[model samples]
Target: MQAKPLTIITQNEKMRNIFSGIDHIVASDSSILLIGETGVGKELFAEYIHRTSPRQMQPFIKVGLSALPAELLESELFGHEKGAFTSAGNEKKGLFELADGGSIFLDDIDDFPYQLQSKLLRVLESRELMRIGGQVSIPINVRLITASKNNLHDLVEKGIFRADLYYRINVVPVDIPPLRDRSEDIPLLAEYYLKKFAPEKEIKIEKEALRKLILYQWPGNVRELRNVVQRISLFASNEIKVEDLPSEIRNDHPMQSLTKACHRCLTNEEMTFEEVVACLEKNLIQQSLKETNGNKTQAAKLLKMNFSTFRDKLKKYLME
Candidate 1:
């Protein structure tokens, strides 16, 4: 049986458009690219596509690209021989074969290395896969869907990502705007989780607490919000109150500071709030670099920034 597209629980026109776009792309065999921030429910969107796609009856395989090492990732994607590696106990069909007549979700495609990109491209183009430790190739009939939190175009510019591969997977691109950008959807999503989690724990959220949840920026996004609801539900009376909400949101300092810092720079064009915060962030990063003795890479992690983002910030701040 095919899973139906969960009645889209949204009213925002932009998000509604994204849902329609996904609905359209699923009907064909085109490889799709879903780009957004972490905790943005990319996988849920993938499931929505698969359930609505023509291959709904077949397997829906998901490969977490970030979880596997290069050598293992290759075999995991395109299965290897029984004795292909030091620890091969049995022959396993690759995800492509498992998903034959269905769909394969390659989550976190941004983490794919240069070496494995070529093999993936080959399989994508020909719809064929070879099992590890096997000498023969098998035909594969599956749709591809990839999700990423990183910008593929930036990766291409740095040569870490192959341009051709980028084009291949990016054939049908869908952008999932962050939760903060789509505040309208928060109340609905919150109520969805609250009811879903509440019944499991025999608790309920007061109307006011629900409103508080709807107002927060939720930097951690849906997942974090769900966790907050779950945590609060455990201790919440049959009726949850504002006092029961997580302390972080009630007294969220970093966000408060960030919010305050942003409000102060609202009128600056050349220095948008993001730029201002980033400028402050760059200063912090530069301090880390100085402490680390001019090592930009290490300084990046110290500042909790992506290496590339850190480098870009360095250039933007004229630190280099």
Candidate 2:
């Protein structure tokens, strides 16, 4: 069977720009480092890269490095010979060997064991690996794609990650924006998932419910939105009403509201104080727009700002 092409639904300008850049380098053998929060679909991005690459026909292996126990991680990645360890009865091919002439996506690479990083680096550098307790060297050709939930540079500085290994994997870093950063895509994604989960029924989300989805911060990003849509699709009628939404989303706590408003200030370590203020201002303007249903004049009035100033702010923040 032919492999299906990746369809990442996004109308956001930033995301479009990111994809544009990615398209230019899909054929290159350079390592790609995907940096994003948990549940932001880094694995999806990795698959997209591999699917579009020249090695698409070859095996594409994905491994969540963080999910593996440290003690067994080495054996899993580099494989083992028979009698390599007490439990090793049969020789096995490592993920690298299995992904030879293709791609290997190592998610949560920051969590990869420090001791094993050098071995990984050596394989990537030499294009060869030796099975545990085996004398023969096995050559492999695989494109490396790594994803990290945290900044690998910070980990390197903290002595938790190897700097040399970091440089080797940091050939082309791609930062995926969180769902909140690309709120414009929420409605599109929601509709996409609605049709996906309930193709038989032509269900639709009510305007108010969609507004709540767009306004509420998605801490889990796109993954959270998919789950929400899947849950509601199961019980939704012709139209999904506000009451049909989850209670937490319908009745956001005041503290959660505050956090949402100041999310950039709190979570982003790279943002300066001024940037945080600008973020807050942009968020407030966005909230007003959502509340007034995209009526610029009404949104301006709701924020108690002069129409010209509001318009300028909207243009300044590129919301216009």
Candidate 3:
């Protein structure tokens, strides 16, 4: 049977370039490693590779390695014969066997147990496996696609991941850009999901609401956006207003916004304590002035500083 075409709902140029690269090599069987933060849709990218590959008609199995228990991971990936363990009641094919002549996506490969790395490497190298308690070695023909939220190279450097296996899987690496880096796509995605979840309603996002969506950093990426849209769909009126957005998006927490404003000061290692303090103070003064409509005395009072002290600060920070 023919596999359904993979649909990646992205208008971002970074994503487009990534997909273009994937298309160029989908015909090859090289191991593809997808690197992205959690909920950045690594699994979707894996499926895209599989569905567009020469083995599209073949089975495409996906396994979240982090979700599986450490004790059962080996057995699950390599299969097990009946009586292999106390809980083993029937012989079964491992994911690799089931994905013969196909692709198997291993999400969170960084969480794969260290001791089992060698066994996994052996399978990838030899294209064969020996099920637990089975004598015969089963030859397999499967394409391996793995994903990691952490840089596998960093894990290897720390000795948590095997270097050999890291080299094996790092053949074709693809780095997915986070949503915050591609704000242009926010409106398109929000509109698409709104239509999907509220097909019966003429739901639309107000300009202010859409602006907030683009401004707020989506730490959870596309998944979080989808959830937010789905939740609002149930309660939103025909026009989704800024007030309809979750508080986090509509109004960032004061501290969060402050931290963002002072990000450079906080992260720059060369900045001294006094410099950082000055940076924070300047930002606070600017914010206070904006809030008080340029009323220096009111700004000073709001910041709990004497007018004289606030005047000196304004001059010091070049606000005067």
Candidate 4:
């Protein structure tokens, strides 16, 4: 059997570097821990790792620990023998048993019950498990991949997660960068989604619309962006303009935007005052140009600068 092809579209250099480093790790069967904020595509990363691994041909099972109820989570993960409980009509296989000779992705591992952490740790260490209410141990050979939105170490200190379990699963931790931290990828992702949602239409995103998509902080991350694109595609006839975007995105507060940019400048010790000033000026010129729809005279008037000075600055910044 051959592994199905999986694609992870990203333009960010940091993400590319991560994929490069993960190529080496995928060759081994070490337990992988992916840590990232919600909607940062941790599950997609897990799938990518599995698809690239030697066990790619085998089953890649994914279980969302947070979605499972506390009472049923144990049985869902570890199986149950006949008559194990009132609801049990026959023996059932657990996720670990089902994923034998392959890989198991335990998403939102932090939500896993604290008492069950030891059992998970034991399976990771011994490659075996016992069915619920059954005495016989079942041998298994499954690769482990876990993900968490919060830091497992913090949960450990708070006595919410086991320290030993954290150490066992975090053998090769991968921290996924947030969408805000990788804004450069926004345009690429937006265009991808636009084409995906409206393949039949000759749809194009205007420069100012793309700029707004890039500027607005995507709290829900890529998932939110995808939804927004899909909505736009359904309603937008031909081209997506700035007014076509949602009010929150279009009405980005100038003060908030400036503060965020300044915060980046303040945090970076390597950035000189002159460089920061130049960057800010370039952004202002670009924003003015977008607002005036590339009209140089109007943009100059909006920015309270002489037309000739604006042209000179544009040339200096290579905006021409």
Candidate 5:
């Protein structure tokens, strides 16, 4: 049973070794940075850390740093004092104070601007927060767990982020690999979602459908797979059939958009400019003629070429 949202799988020795050090990672009195791609569940992993830690009973404050306007993010994180801004009527406690004695998950941490890095550095260093425009610093003991879907090294090289701050937070780095790299787990994930989603809609997933699902690359990762399974379970029958797949996946989607769309790619690579043009002209003429029910004049108009020119191109391609 997966007790946490970020189901930490110790499937391999590598993962087992990594997870073995998880206690040290979470128990450290310093900031922990979790890095992974979008949709790979970085926030979920952060939640796991909070849930397993001693501060599990305390509120787990979630701060979406990227969602916040950069101008006001610092104020939101560190709190604001009276007259700090046009709307600053009263001194407000930031996430740090609100999450005192608990864990704070800072999602999309890379979006944090360098301008506020020093302010954040102070908070991390002092274990306290000072509201904007406030004279007195408030002591707040909050464990910080941050996640980013970006390459911090690239940001550092570009000089957009502070190197000192990056090193401070990256004391124990947890990098989550994408779903594609772990295709071996696709069947497992599919079955899990199938069991979860099937009962609500009275449906059963077909083994063949599961096979197809496992084969395709889930670009959107687990989230995308969950969506697919959800839809299938909702619309499909007690015994799911291959034909019951969503129309997009059921048919040859790439070619059916246009009959000649597939052919375009095939012969384009081998044909010279004139040959390619001739092929395209033939295709257009044939398509227009078919749509117009073999009416030459209508086909010519559709092709936007005169009857003679259209006929000439058609014959040229046919003979070639």
Candidate 6:
């Protein structure tokens, strides 16, 4: 099956480069280890890789290790035969078995039990598993993708994670930068979530509101941002203003400073229309460049301009 278009909207140079690298890795059958903070969209990245791989038509199963109790996680991952345990009245298939010929994503792999890591490593190495209380070794052809909020390397050093298992899964490591590190993508992500949650409404975010969003440090990352947008959109009018934002975001000091600047600009009558527009454009471009750490490509993307057009504007403003 043809893969659907990617919904991972990002223009940050680092993320773009990571995606490009992932494109090459997806063609091959290799274990992928995605490392990132919680709510940084590691699971989404795993799904994207699976969707783009040859296993697009096959089943894609996701199991969160942290969510499952240790007592049931083993059976949930490797399945169980009839009478394997008191609750096992019927034979059951595991996530790996269900994901045969496709991909299986194990989220929060760092939280996976230490004892079970060896079994998981064995599966990765042999591509086979034996259901609990069963004699047959069932072969599987599922691609393995594991995600961790904590660094597996450090966990291995601390003896929390199995070193061998870590090596096995770390075949292709993908690190997702936190939202705070890639603030340049904030506007785009906020807009994307806004459209997703309120598709029926043609809502616009005021400049001050957007500045507040961009300035606030998103502790919960993309997930929190999505929730914030959803909440604000629900109560907002045709336009979302600073006051419509959550209290934590609305009261940010940086946002207050930006609002003051905007007020000053509006009150200034000495500045010509062309001069005011030019000044605002220059400031926006500079801000974009600053957020992207001087990466022109990403700065242009943040400004919603073509690379050539952005360069021309830079030259016109004597910014280059």
For this target, which candidate reaches the highest lDDT against the unseen true structure? 3
lDDT (Cα atoms) of all candidates against the true structure: 0.77, 0.87, 0.88, 0.86, 0.73, 0.86
What does candidate 3's lDDT look like per residue over 1-320, in tens digits?
66888667777888999999999999999999999977789999999999989899999999999899999998889999999999999998899999999999999999999999999999999999999899999999999999998889988989999999999999999999878779888898898898989999979888878888998767678999999999999998799998888887887633456556677778888889999899889988886665445767556755779887999998898889
lDDT of 2 by residue, 1-320 (tens): 34579888999998999889988999899999999977789999999999888989899999999889988898899999999999999998899999999999999998998888899999999999999989999999999999998889989999999999999999999999878789899999999999999999899888988888887666667898899999999998789988999875785532355447667666888989898889888888886665444767656755679888998998899987
TM-score of each: 0.78, 0.79, 0.81, 0.79, 0.72, 0.78
Q: State the lDDT at 157 in candidate 5.
A: 88
* Worst ten in a row by lDDT for model 1: 252-261
Query: What tens digits encode model 1's per-residue C-alpha lDDT throughout 205-318?
Result: 677776666666565667777788777766766777878877645543333434444454455668866677776665576556643347565456546788978888778888
Best by TM-score: 3
In the order shown, what is each candidate's alpha-carbon RMSD? 6.7, 10.7, 10.4, 12.5, 12.1, 12.6
Error of 3 at 27 (Å): 0.4
Residues 184-241, candidate 5: write the lDDT tens digits.
7666766677777775554555787655555554446667767877777777657667
Which pairs clash in the backbone of model 3?
none
Q: Could you give the candidate ranking by lDDT, starting with the highest?
A: 3, 2, 4, 6, 1, 5
- Candidate number that wins on TM-score, 1 or 3: 3
Count of steric clashes across candidates, in order: 6, 0, 0, 0, 0, 0
lDDT value, residue 1 of candidate 6:
45
Task: Show the colliding residue pairs in model 1.
Answer: 79-131, 79-132, 80-132, 80-133, 81-132, 81-133
Model 2 CA deviation exceeding 4 Å by range: 252-256, 259-320
> How displaced is residue 189 in candidate 1, in Å?
1.6
CA-RMSD of model 3: 10.4
